[model samples]
Target chain A: MDLIESYKEDLRLIRRFGTGFWIVLLLIGLILLPWFAREYWVYVVTLIFIYSIGIQGQNILIGYTGQISFGQAGFLAIGAFTYGHLSLLGSPILVNLFFSGLMAGIFGILVGFPSLRLKGPYLAIVTLGFGIAVYQVFVNSEILSGGRMGLTIQKLQPLFGLSQMTTYYYFNFILVFLFTLLSYNLISSFVGRAFIAIRDNDIAAEAMGVSLTRYKLLSFAISSFYTGVQGGLYALLMGYLEPNMFTFLETITIFVAVIIGGLASVEGSILGAAFVVMVPQVFSNTKAFIPVIYGVTILIILIFEPLGLSGRWMKIRLYLRMWPFR
Target chain B: MPLLEIKDISISFGGIMALSGISLQVQEEKIIAVIGPNGSGKTTLFNCLTGIYHPNEGEIHLNGENILRLSPDAIAELGIARTFQNLRLFMNMNVLDNLLVGRHLHFRKNPLLPMLRIRKEEILHRKIIEEIIDFLDLQAYRKARVADCPYGVQKRVELGRALALEPKLLLLDEPISGLTSEEKEEAAYRINEIRGRFQMTILLVEHDLRIASRLADSMVAFYYGQKIAQGTPEEVQRNPEVIRAYLGDD
Candidate 1:
């Protein structure tokens, strides 16, 4: 049995020595992956990292905060286009990423305003409208999205004798790692408690002195900021920006990742992102059957494990922990 | 000055009056029990005081400052904490987390500090929470999910959450309504102890007149959205209007 002698120990992210050991081992594996894997596999894994960041954001809003959002793609689009324009203006890549996230976060707060009064399907519809509207705006505006021809992003300069792809891969890996830690810290703290409290029971939460307006807007800003950064990374990855690339479908895919991976879990976001990214590649030859496979897989997973893959992972851990008895 | 003062407050839903011209004063460190039948506006009075239901007319003063117009969170920040008639604990969160949420107003708002897991600030908060857990005898159930807890334990958790706020005035709505006889006695003992221990005023809504009268230094009886009687528990119970309200005119 794991015994916590102090409150600090209880609040630790990796409480157990065994868990920390496994995490360190996993980190080593991730560091070695790019070297051993083929170029296609490396590219796929990089896509997973980018989507994982975005999925973490979605999980924060929908999973932890209990706020429904269908406009995640809109924020992603805003981030991508912001990066595209800033990079064209000869700015540093990191600065462009920061500005891209900042711009999207500003829009996120704007979208979060309606959530103060709207909930469930009403909030969903408003966000859906936002996603569609963002796509339309980019398609129609030439200066913004290159008038349907789309914008081209400049390639990154490789550093320290590494290939451009490897550099991009390392950059994303570092970001994803940092963001995951950031989110874990966020959820475990007072801020995360407020968000969960609002989700579980807003009335009691309010009585406990948690401001609904402040935290809801804060959740939006933080969630979208992550998605926005992911969008900037996506722009760098593809070296192109099209209005069509960030359609409602992109939002749905992210949403699916959150649900299928698990709600309110950082590890779930990574698992879900990997699943969504890899599945498409796995069925590249049979692209038409991808949707059918996705639908069937989601239904099957939800039916047996409603909490998603992370929940199953937890059960497996629990079973192993109680193996001799159970 | 009284810790809380409600003056001629009235609220209505469409045409039906939920609370009408109700007024009361709560002194510091005293237990004032409100005894009433169901739908007698006891809960509504609590709601108005907590800023959940805005009174259509009249002013509420907390420490001489007008608070009726403030939101629920604002009222909470002004040293008023409450328990719901129906339990409103965060079911998905663990018992400790539910209490930690009660310490929401006390924690620093700097997002950066928590991101870094600043040991000093976090340890301070955790220390306060640990004390509350000990006081409420919730150590065994600290890590247990609130949903999995029994009803009596859940009720204690609700009370513990309010205590974590460390408010000046506590409004408890049917705190022991659904508990067993043993749990009821235990809750009553805790309620009586809380006034002296926490040094806070309490405004309690209860259907159990016997327990309410025993716990209260003073009692006010409500009947059909109006105060029927107000005095010491003995005097209020002896009043003809209170008797009529409870026992009926026939």
Candidate 2:
């Protein structure tokens, strides 16, 4: 018991102080990443950050509200289109991005309102239809969206005078940090609790005076907004936008990032994003065998650890933490 | 008129009648217990009151407003709160969060205000949250996860959440059915405490006859899907139909 108590004390200390230290350490590493790594690795890190933003939104929707959305990518496209179109019209990058996200939020509210009314599989199908519809809209809207061929997106200039990769690297890094911190705070607040209440048991939550319809719609709106921001960022970073860019496959890719990382965990999103972005490149050398290996590995994870790689790692960590005393 | 009146409420599922022309009036600030055997439609009545299942026939009035047309959440907004027969506490949240969620309907502020860190909204939210935490003596578990808590504490947490709404009328469906005798005593104390301390009106649905007799001001007994007897606790206890239906024989 004494050993357990002592261990708990250490765990508390780690949670309280260790997190700050690690965050600082992570910032330093991220800052230095461009110094040692090539342009390709920098690209990979950017992808991770972008994917993590979507994963964070998914975490809120799935983890707290227990509402599964397969249409986050569609919202992302709306955001991307809003930003890309506005920037092409010579709007400032930040303004374009912000308004793009807001625009996505409007669509989210639109999609969320009806989707929330439906239950389970109905909700999924509706959102799935949304993704397909958006893809089609981008394809058929030739004059505005540039049809299937795509358009070159405007590269956002640095907020400062520096035009170097260093400045852009740091800017993207800040995006990741700000997004993570905001997501964390929102998920830990009263609104977050309401989301969890709805998720855990809606009937009980309603009795406690939780407005299920409003809050369920709110989750969809919020998640869609974040996913929208991610879409805007994707367009800016790629210096391009196209119908082909946002696809049905991208929705599955978002799922892979979140589920493989950890469904409800923020760190899992980051880890999953990094893994998803990096593994494809590393396996590029293997070529033929990579897809088979990837498929089998994903199948194993689904069968053995539906909670994802982070969940498995957590069990190991718990076991290690409980060693000796156990 | 009584504080809450349900008149001729009938709800049917396909061909089966869940509740048929059930009507009851609850006077203000009274401990009214609804007791019945299984499948007597006791929970179905609670569901109708809370707007879970809309009645095919009848009207419910709260404070002279027709609540039958109100959605479950709308009914809740009109100062009515409830607890499920099945322990339906937000099981994954902390004690404080559980109570905080209860104030969702009461805390009416623009969602954007909190995100913007609007000082006034934050202050009001914090004040409510603190008040609820203090009321429940849940300050200790404010940061603890709900999944780790025991069943009894979870029950109390659910009660705390309902109390957070500051409802004029509380509908507790089987608040003490699954509790131990010790828990039943505790539950009875809490119910009395709310009545005495908060001066809140309560309608309890319980299986424990002894608990009912001790806590209730009046008792309403149901057989099948209709109310067989309702009066002062002593009057209802002595009612022959209640005795035959519940007390077996004397």
Candidate 3:
């Protein structure tokens, strides 16, 4: 009983002050990382932030709304291509990225209109088909993608006189921060409550005055906006665009990331994004082992820790607070 | 105008008629108890009113405005809320969140602005939910997840969630059917208090005749998807058809 009371005190302290301190510490580390870390590691971290944005959107839709979407990569491709097309026409990068997200949101609404009516496997199939169809069509269309050879973006001047990589990294960091704050605000508010309500019981939610069509579409559009922004950033970072870049496998990887990170949690998305992005790199020498490793890791997480890596992280914190006590 | 008028509503699924040309007129601030055996179409009537199932041929007017064409949420926005026979209180969420979800209609429609801050609207809505919790005496279980709560508490939470919507008309399907005798009495008291305190019309469907008899201002009895009797509770209970339906023609 005494241990339990002490543990509660520890938890209160963590909740009150420890969390903010850790977040500030993490931010400080990230800020200083680019200056001290290898250039390759900085690039990898940038990619992780971009993917975190996309995964966070997925978490909102899949975790919060209980909607299954396998076509986030399609929106990503749309954003990248939109950026590529507009940038080719001499628009500024910022304007192109903004339009890229806009175009993706429009496409998301288009898909959401028909697909929101589907449930379970049908929804997944429709979204997966959409992802594949977008890739195939873009690859075939000479107007969109130079007929599979792809379009190359010229090296542009870096923002604020920083190196291209540093500028890109900082820009991504700001976006990730803004989106994290936005998602945090959203998940704690009534809108997020509505999403969880719809997810838990649509019939009850509808009877209580939640508009299923409107909220579902809103989730879809906002999620697509996040993925689209990531896509736009990807184009800027890679300085090249191709239909092949946003693959079916990439879509699956993102879905896996959301699940592995823990559904419906912003922290889960970040952890899951980092894990998925880094694992393949770790196994780069043995390409065939990557799929086996991914599958095994997911299975283990599901069987042993249904809440995924973040859930385990939580348990670890609790265990540490209650050390040596049952 | 009657507060709610269901005129000649008929809904059929293939060959089986769920509700057949049933018309009901609900006056403002009245508690009407609908009693029937299982599969007798009491729930179907509530479904039609809430726009879950559209009547094949009928008109539904709430305060003289036709509500038959509206979607469920749109109908809800016009101030009609319901509780299910089987409790459907967002089981994964805590009681507070479930009640907050009931305020979905009161939220701003932009969906973007709320993502920036907690917002004054949420604070205002939270106050409303707090009042509902106080009314329902759910302060003890405010943070308890609905799934973790007992059946009685779950029913209370469901009622509290519906009340949070602040609907002009509340449709309750078997609000106390699964409760213990003590829980039933408490639920009855709350239901009675609700009408006077909230100034809302109520249409309740219950299988418990004794509780219905004591609680309902009026009573409607259903037998085989048809209304056999509707009047003051004593009048409905005295009708031969209602007796035959419940007792099966001894």
Residue pairs in clash, model 3? none
TM-score of each: 0.98, 0.90, 0.95
Docking class of 2: acceptable
Candidate 3 or 2, higher DockQ: 3
Candidate 1, residues A42-83: lDDT per residue as tens digits? 889999999999999989999999999999899999999999
Task: Write candidate 2's Cα lDDT for A13-128 as tens digits.
Answer: 13545457877898899888887888777777877888788778877887668887788778888999888888878878788878888888888888888755786778888888
Residue pairs of candidate 2 with colliding backbone atoms: none
Note the B-chain TM-score for every model: 0.97, 0.92, 0.97
lDDT of 2 by residue, B52-125 (tens): 88899889999999988777788888988888777787776767667778777766556664454343543465
Model 2 has a DockQ score of 0.42
- Candidate 1 local Cα displacement, residue A151, angstroms: 1.0
Q: Please report the candidate that would top lDDT against the real structure.
A: 1
**Top TM-score prediction, candidate number:** 1
Candidate 2 regions exceeding 4 Å error are A1-15, A158-164, A285-298, A302-306, A309-326, B116-143, B247-250
Please report how far candidate 1 places residue A123 from its true position, in Å.
Answer: 0.5
Report the error of model 2 at residue B167, Å: 1.1
Tens-digit lDDT track of model 3 for B117-146: 636676677778888999888988977889
